[model samples]
Target chain A: MRRSMLFIPGNTPNLLMNGDVLGSDAIILDLEDAVSPAEKDSARILVRNALKHLHYKGCEIIIRINPVDTEYWQKDLEEVIPLKPNLIMPPKVSCAQDVKTVSDYIAKLEEKCGFEKNTVKLIPLIETAMGVENAFQIAGADERVAAMFLGGEDLTADLRCKRTKEGNEIFYARTRLVCAARACGIDVYDTPFTDVDDLDGLYKDAQFAKSLGFTGKASISPRHVEGINEVFSPTQAEIDYAHEVMETIRIAKEQGKGVVSLRGKMIDAPIVERARQVIEMEKAMFGGVEDDE
Target chain B: MKITANAVAGTLESSDVYVKVEPCDTLEIEIESVVYNQFADDIKASVKEVLDELGVESGRISINDKGAIDCVIQARVETAIKRAGGNK
Candidate 1:
């Protein structure tokens, strides 16, 4: 039920152990980019131990393992997959085959570890241009993928574009990723807003993210989590409006009417669907904000 | 240790997650709970850190102590964010 996922460096034991203290819908213990080459094994050991020792209820604990192409991935997965995290985020996923490959790896690993095959889910990150282009295929490749995220910082670098604070350079890519995820019926997460000090900017960007149809967002800092959660989530006004629209539609249907009007605005099936989506968004955010329908 | 994402279970004391929108676009969070008091500063700091990290501007926040753990505070903040429409 977490809408904003906070990424804490894997080596930072304080943050990792106390991440529930930070207000993220989920927390990612990063054993990938956040861990330098020297700290790799130590970070993994720390995270694996912490995952075993701590109990962060209500917040999902996801481990972002190193990408399959990396030298450390096999060892990383060997140590991590058995911890039974809420989910596993596979970095730098490029295509359907990449997802299938990881799924196969997890399946094999599960048997070796005596765990249920595919008990854990994957959240592939579309961090590269090729990954973005193949996002749909990647998402649809395996049911083990619970959702997917856009890694715009890396994607921008791969595309050879400078990232502006306004996020102008990646608008097209972001839209494409969202469209791809929605089309495939999987949840889509927007890239993190990097300006930790700029709350207003974060706020505006979050609103922009919501309007773009992303279900959730990533956060480099815990501060961005609430903002992202707030921005991407449906407002009470929006939720209530959605309820009224749906209720009106239900009444119209009860009276055998198809197209109807709510406060003089024409209400139709698309409107009902949109309203239903908003209500679902509200529920996803607040957990209790759902329309009876 | 934290609690599960379960039902309201019991409200120990009739409780609420207090929130006020400031005139200056700051989202002020104050959690009033009969249960908030039993928790330590680390837990309180955890709550404050979430509000601070969440990019709330020009707001004053106070969590009324109730005997809530780290997880409950986190869940309450998430609830506040949702109530505020995740105003982002």
Candidate 2:
């Protein structure tokens, strides 16, 4: 999961172009809520052209299309999915069956388009209370589903509550979303910090979200990407400590020692696993070289 | 320096080297030549590292193997990137 997924309003070409230049690991060309219905088709064409032509190396491209249940969805899918983006973030996914529908269409489209089967994944966003209740079923509906994102502002509106600074009102929903995703073995992403100028606030919120096991957060502004990445990245100190712990364990095992201590802390199963996860995440987050098989 | 070549993945009857320069979003240069299996993996890694070090991460990259030397591989990639206005 990326530390921050930068979202570009679908109608702005310059914003789309800056997505790669601004250093976000992933860029979402949003067509659903950010775009007005009057400009939705134009937004689709713009996003399609960008996907087919833009030079965004190593940036995962996600297109947030309109809800599948809407009248415009099929055309949106037909026009954009063929471009073969990294993933499609379907909004307002209500159940297992909802995701399955998109998954089935994607499979057929891959065959028809001559792209690799299952090359594109689905990110079903839970934006309503009903969707939150059905989160597990929705997340597990497709094998190609990668992550579930909490769409808080929309969700709050649906729930008819004013969102709080600490997000206390949405705590239950956030925890529920995380549990559902984890139960189904998928990643859960937190909603963006809407206040782009509030860098400290964004960092605090992102850190809090990370503590709660949300893998990453979304960003509304390009400026937010750096801060989010900073919060999520393993500092050199952490990385080095993890490496030391891992090496100590390996050495101790080679020496046939049942127990090992590194810097007064016992090296054990959980610690070793955490270290390994850190390493793996670093590899995933950064474009580490993997031999093409 | 100008480069023009294309490569495909398959066995080569004799050792051959083909190169090309095309517009690539991420591929800097790709070399497709038949190489000894024992050295193929190492050669690919070395070439990728060199390209990465040179800050050429995006472009059309296609490599066809024909059992070339490390020197030949370096020369070919450098030649191709230079043709694409990359630092020679």
Candidate 3:
């Protein structure tokens, strides 16, 4: 249900206070790239206090901790894990070992804090060339990895290429990640659309990602949430077609027919599965309230 | 815990408060806030609560607030006290 996860700077109190009301499905309280080194401790304390005192309802709470390679990550985890955010996003993940390292630490912390095992989940940010190469292994590294987030800006830099609106450079990596995550039976998220002002480009980019099997997309700006959610959600026509597919299947089963066809085309297992997914998505999004056709 | 040297935390940004702590002979707290007329007592109470939780005594605590809530004030105070070498 994470169609859009917006990034809110961890140190900015003003933004942190209003994060849940911004229409994002999830709000990522960022401590990695958003806060400066000098203010890392301050930001950590502020974020911890915000989580403890403020009630952010409806939206999932994700804390993007600093990379495992840095000294700040341990401190970040120590402060946030006890509060039990929905997910902890580890950046610059290069391999399965990186995921294991963070997951192992979380397991230890969960025990020490007397919380249920695997209470905190991980969303590894795959941005390096090595990470893309080992996407499959990383996706299946641990049980705590709920999803994989593609960080296009960092990935392009790691690839030694310039990022563009067309996103041709990241095509291979994007497809590879999708295939890996799908094969592992986990969700995959596309990177944020960096150009906040260009709504047209954002829509096209999101559409392309959805076509390539991205379950959802991250957003750096609040303005991109609606467009991303719209792109990922099943359309009215799709929902109606799903309902027809299910109804036809039900009728075929009751009639003792060996085969079923909808609109003169065979409704096979694959089509039925896709229709089920569409129907499930519609239910989740609109609470099973069907719109007038 | 004691404040051995001067330390500051937080920024004067909107919805934030700047906290500074230093060594003093007796406990002293000074607050200058945009919402002074409305929430000065609550702000002082939050600062004192954090200091008490950290076991901080005998220090000069100063707050420059820009309408920060109680949590923000407490966090800033805690961070400043920690930076001043206050161990709890």
Candidate 4:
């Protein structure tokens, strides 16, 4: 799972070329709202060529195409589908049909370009109340969908609610998105923290999202990546306890025991499962170096 | 391909290069770059390479560079050439 997905303006050449080195787990080359209308065509060309030419150093390349209803999205798909971005993020997705529209177009592009089928994934941004209510359907709309992202700014605007750093107004929508994504068995990413200069607020917001079970957070700037990554990653103490729990469970299994105890506390199946998840998460983040004997 | 009309691509922004192409009897390439004295030869070579690849023999290519790298330069030049040739 990604801890942070950095959004870089697709038309900004310097950012597009250097986004991978910013330490984000994924880099989003955004051709949607981040780009101006006059530069839409130019941005599409730049993003397509960037995908064709640049290597993102193992960071998952996610291109945020313009909304499905726009004229720019089809052209964006035509230009970048052959290049095979890791994910195509459709912004302001309101229903399952929005996801299907992009998916069907992608299938056609795959057949025409002869690229490997199903290589391009989709992550629809849930921005409206309809999108949040239909989140599960959208998440399960296509097998190609890997995750769903909650777009708080646009969502608040759509809901006619005030957006504050505490994010109390969006709590219901955020929790609903998490539940929908979990029910669909796909990851969920929280919206970006807009206050770039307020690292403390960013940290608190990221921690809040993590508590809500978001797998990652979107970053508007590279400066926020480090904070989000730290918040999402398992701590050393948690990793050590997970290791101990696993070892205890393994010993119990060897002894033909169904119940296990570690540090005077009985370990249940759920505890053991959580331990395994923590270990797996640690490995995914640290490249399995923590798993070394 | 020969340039038939005036065409331009890209913008005069930082890390971007603005390219202008117009019809000319003889090829004349001019560049104004932030790093003109340092990487002028590399930039000129990149532009020439793209011109050769497009098979454009005679055209006046004016490049207003703002420290764009080779890839950006090549993309801008190719786009300008395509526009000049009335392809897009």
Candidate 5:
């Protein structure tokens, strides 16, 4: 249900106070790139306090800690893990070992805090060339991995290529991540469309990601949340078709028939599954409203 | 705990508080908040709460608040004290 995960700078109190009202399905409190080195300690404390006191209604809380290679990451984990955010996005994860390292550390922290084991899930940011190459292994590395996230900006940088607005360069990475996450039976998210002002471009990019089977898209700007949500949400036509498909299957089942057909075309298992997915998405987005009889 | 050095945390941004801690023989807190008339006592109480939790006995604590709430005040004060290297 994470259609749009908006990144909020960890140290900015103004944004943190109003995060819940921003219309994003999830909000990433960014502690990695958003906060300067000097402010890292301060930002950690601030984020910790915000999590403890503030209630972010109806949005998944994700804390994007610094990469595992840095000195700041462990401190970041120690501070936020106790507060129990919905997910922790480890940036620049390169392989299965990296995911293991974070996961193992979290397991220990969860135990030490007297919380349930694996209470905090991970969404690894596969941003580097090595990460993309080992995306499958990384996604399957630990049971704590709830999803995978593509970092196009860092991936392109690692690939020594210019990241154009058209995203011709990242097409392969996007598809590869989708395949890898799908193989692991986990959700995958696309990177933020960095050009915040271009709504048309955002829509196109979101649609492209959706077509490639991305579960959702991340956004650095609040302006893109509505558009991303719209792109990922099931359309009225799709909802209606899914309802018709389900109705057709119900009638066929009542007739004790092994075969089912919809609109003169055979409706097989794959089609039925797709229809259920569409219906599920519709319910999640629209509060499980019953279809018109 | 004793404040070992001068340290500052937070910023003068809106909905935030800038906190500074310095070594002193007696604990003293000075606050200048945008909402001083309404929430100054609550802000002071928040600062004292963090200071007491950190076992801070003596320091010159100064705060420049820009309409920050209790949690923010507590966080900034705690951060400033920790950055000051309080000897536990």
Candidate 6:
């Protein structure tokens, strides 16, 4: 149910302390690109202490550790593992073996630290062309992988294509990731909209992501959270239509009919099932009612 | 155990403390806190409690405090002592 996942730099003390009030469904304490090499150690210590002491109001805490190719990632894991963040996002994940290597490392750490096995979830960032080619295998690499994040900026760089406001360059990459994630029954997230000042553009991009079947979007700033959440949530009209389709299908089932008609439209099994999914998504997004029937 | 080397822990950030431990013949403390006039005594007592718990008999523990809470202060001091004693 993560509509917006915000990235907060791990080196900034003020932002780390104020993370709980930011209103994002999840917070990513970034220890990689946001932190300078000189400040890497300090950021790791700060993030570790924050995870041990601070509470983000039950928001999922995700630590974007340094990439696996660096010396800092091992230390990052050693310090951050004991505290147990909700998810660990590995950057530059170029293949399925990358996911497996990290998963194995986490498994060993969990055993040594006496933590419940498989408690830590992984959401790997697919940022390269190699990663895009192997998206399906990466998505199904491990049981702990709950989602795949498509990183557009880096992917465009890997493709040597220019990034434009219209997002035409990333269409193929995003579409591929969506299909791969859906095939594995896991969620997929879009990269942060880099133009922080363009609210209109952000809205358009979020709407496009939603249409492309992204469950949520990653945000670089706090202001983008509300917009992303709204774009991904099922609208009131959509909820009403879904309920109508469900009711019609239920009546048809009682009458021993294999098909149903709603407003002169043929409602088959797949259409009704999609409607049921929409209703369920609405409930998950705004949880006030329970499905007893 | 006696602190035989210069060791440090924590940082001088908000809600954190930078602790440095040096070998000395007797227990010595130098605390520089933002709230020196208000919570100086309490801060010193907290550091002393942690030092005693670590069985540190002699060391010069320098604390550069930035409004860190009691638990953070204790953790910083304990980490500094362990680093100085080579036990961590």
- Give the chain A TM-score for each candidate: 0.92, 0.93, 0.97, 0.96, 0.98, 0.94
Q: What is the lDDT of residue B73 in candidate 5?
A: 87
lDDT of 5 by residue, A1-293 (tens): 78899999999999998899999999999999999998898889999999999999999999999998898998999999999999999999999999999999999899999999989999999999999999999999999999999999989999999998899999999999999999999999999999989999999999999999999999999999999999999899998899899889888888999998888899999888988889878878878577532
Q: How well does model 6 score by local distance difference test?
A: 0.87
Off by over 4 Å in 3: A288-293, B86-88
Look at candidate 4 and tell me the lDDT of residue A279.
88
Check candidate 3 and list the clashing pairs: none
Best by DockQ: 3
Candidate 6 error regions (>4 Å) = B1-27, B37-61, B68-88
The order of the candidates by DockQ, greatest first, is: 3, 5, 4, 6, 1, 2
Fnat per candidate: 0.00, 0.00, 0.79, 0.21, 0.79, 0.00
Higher-TM-score candidate among 3 and 4? 3
- What digit string (tens of lDDT, one per residue) describes model 3 on residues A98-200? 9999999999899999999889988999999999999999999999999999999999999999999999999999999999999998989999999999999
lDDT of each: 0.74, 0.74, 0.93, 0.90, 0.92, 0.87
Q: Is candidate 1 or candidate 4 better by DockQ?
A: 4
DockQ of each: 0.02, 0.01, 0.67, 0.46, 0.66, 0.22
Expressed as tens digits, the lDDT of each residue in A1-293 for candidate 1 is 65799999876645665789888889988999998886576567557756766787778988898998888777777777887887889899998988887788888888988987779888999999899888888888998988899988999999999987788888987898888888888888888989899999998888888789888889999878778877766777877889999888878889998678998999977888888888777766557654565
Name the lDDT value of residue A248 in candidate 6.
80
RMSD of each: 16.1, 15.8, 2.1, 2.3, 1.6, 3.3
> Which candidate should be chosen as best, given TM-score against the real structure?
5
User: In candidate 6, what are the lDDT values of residues A1-293, reduced to their tens digit?
Assistant: 67789999986766888887887889999999999886676677678877887777858898999888998887888888998888999999999999988989998998999999988999999999999999999999999999999998989999999988889999998999999999999999998999999999999999999999999999999988889888988889988888888778777778999867898999987787778777788877677755524
CA error at residue B59 for candidate 5, angstroms? 0.6
The C-alpha stretches of model 1 lying farther than 4 A from their native spots are A112-117, A284-291, B1-88
Interface root-mean-square deviation of model 5 in angstroms is 2.6
lDDT for residue A103 in candidate 4, whole number 0-100? 96
Q: How would you encode candidate 4's per-residue C-alpha lDDT over B1-88 as one tens digit per residue? A: 7799999988888999999999999999999999999988899999999999889999999999998877788888887888788766
Q: TM-score order of candidates, best first?
A: 5, 3, 4, 6, 2, 1
- Residue A247 of model 5 has an lDDT of 89
